[model samples]
Target: MSPSHRYEIEGCEVIWAIKDDSIGNTFFDRGAAEFFLPHLTAGKCEENKPLKRLKYTVTESSSDSPKKGDTAMGGALGPDWKDGWRMKGKHDQAAHRVQVEYQCEVQEVLTREEFTRTGQTAECFPGTSRAEEQNDDWPVYVLLTNKRLYGCDFVVSATGVVPSTGPFLHNDQFSVAPDGGLRVDDHMHTSVPDVYAAGDVCTASWEPAPQWFQMRLWSQARQMGSYAAKCMVADRDGEDIDMDFCFELFAHVTKFFNYKIVLLGRYNAQGLGKDYELLLRCTKGLEYVKVVLQAGRMQGAVLIGDTDLEETFENLIVNGMDLSPYGEDLLDPNIDIEDYFD
Candidate 1:
């Protein structure tokens, strides 16, 4: 998940420790593994050949699980891709190319670990039972369910994040959200005056816009930090400032599994109930575009692959333009939607 492995840090050695052998799990926003695996393989080279060129396997429990990126993943990519010319497309292509070109084996591992006696030594490993010591660098391990045994360099647990609330919550000075996050007002101010919280640590306390909700994403963290700073300055001058417009609607753009992912507003049809309608156009191995509409206006959208429709869809969601007349043709690949909207 980090590119720092490419450089040598003086007086520092970084080891990525995780409980699981494979990367990315339910704890991660979907498609995170796809976005990150390439970098990980790219960092490891053998005989001047990048590891990405080697055959590898990506194992998952469920067949449908690999397709999690088909829907909105509830996370945002870094904003650096926002304005760069063709940067978004190129990044998407790279991710997809890695996915298609790489030799990935996907299968389910039913039992992660089980205990059984082997006619071996009593050396202990984290997950498995005692086994006989072998003349290997690391301890020998067995999978009872799969009837397999292997040796490895080390175990790294890549489990997801858990909120650290010991310092703030245990003190009883601040209010906590149901999800164990510190609750903050629209100004990003906590229970105490002149004390504010931003980023993943704080839960949004203000009344959210109809189309907007909070996600512990990097983009939102940056937005909250900036908004909190503005709020602090305004308080010093006794001036008032409205909440930043970024919170009015949700817009996220990122790449996953080599596909361009753009999500806007309630991309997953969140809170829309049964009244909303969905229009979809999908080309196998090419693109998947889905639009959410309430009445006649765009409420949200998910555009995957190089559709190049983010700007138009974003405007449509914001302007509340009625597309009922165009109906299904709104997503027609043959149409020049940009010019039509312009």
Candidate 2:
């Protein structure tokens, strides 16, 4: 069954927009409400007025599409994600269509007084007041607003990706690109010398996704930080660094109303599935099983509804075990494989 569109934010359970309902989604940071632009603008104009707003519309579709009247606007630049322009849409005969308009740069930070008082800018945008909008250099306090502050060397353009979603990498040395993203060389140490970054801040290729990828999950950020630290420490010790671990071993499980969804590895990884064998079964509700193989060994897998099997599944994928030895007997409901997992 197709999963329903549902998510809990700040304890609010939100569902997709239905027919004759004017319900809309919101995009917000700790500061300003970014996704509420349409509503805000709509409030400022007549109901039938064409929206003269600055926003992004998807340029094309790569695979999936959103539901009717559903509009997903955000950058996909986090761990296990890519950095690029994304377009999401849905079709609903009853609700008004979510129209994508123009491209815009969303500034979510502090105000003028707060910026000048301290050299740091807040994490939110509007940044500071109009009075403090003149300063161009970092270490210079340009108040993005009254509540938040930041210490930035430069502001780079992250135009291709979504705005306000913390998908940029966090680096020790900060530099800005002309397009609004940051540039840094120290975070993770690599087999290649002096090339590293962390968080949703960098344009480095070593990231989970390519440049312009939007990343915001805290776990992804922490992992990036840890990996970068490991690299830096390894370099300081003159160690023969191994870069293999940088590859992501993804696992995620979540509920959509009544149904559960689980994903493993980088199932989205291009061409990875070409050589892999797949098995699927439908029992209680919907259960999906995918096994990846390379040279007759298990490379990775995905399991829905049985996260308890994560370790066993991960072991098989990572070690490239000869799953052929067990065959379909492994799926026998009675088999307890946990004992064999290390």
For each candidate in turn, the TM-score is: 0.60, 0.41
Candidate closest to the true structure, highest TM-score = 1
Worst 10 residues of 1 by lDDT: 4-13
RMSD from true fold, candidate 1: 14.7
Residue runs of model 2 more than 4 Å from their true location after superposition? 1-196, 203-218, 233-248, 253-262, 340-342
* TM-score of candidate 2 on Cα atoms, chains taken together: 0.41
In candidate 1, stretches whose alpha carbon ends up further than 4 angstroms from where it belongs are 1-158
lDDT of 1 by residue, 225-278 (tens): 889999999999999999999998987765444355778888877889989888
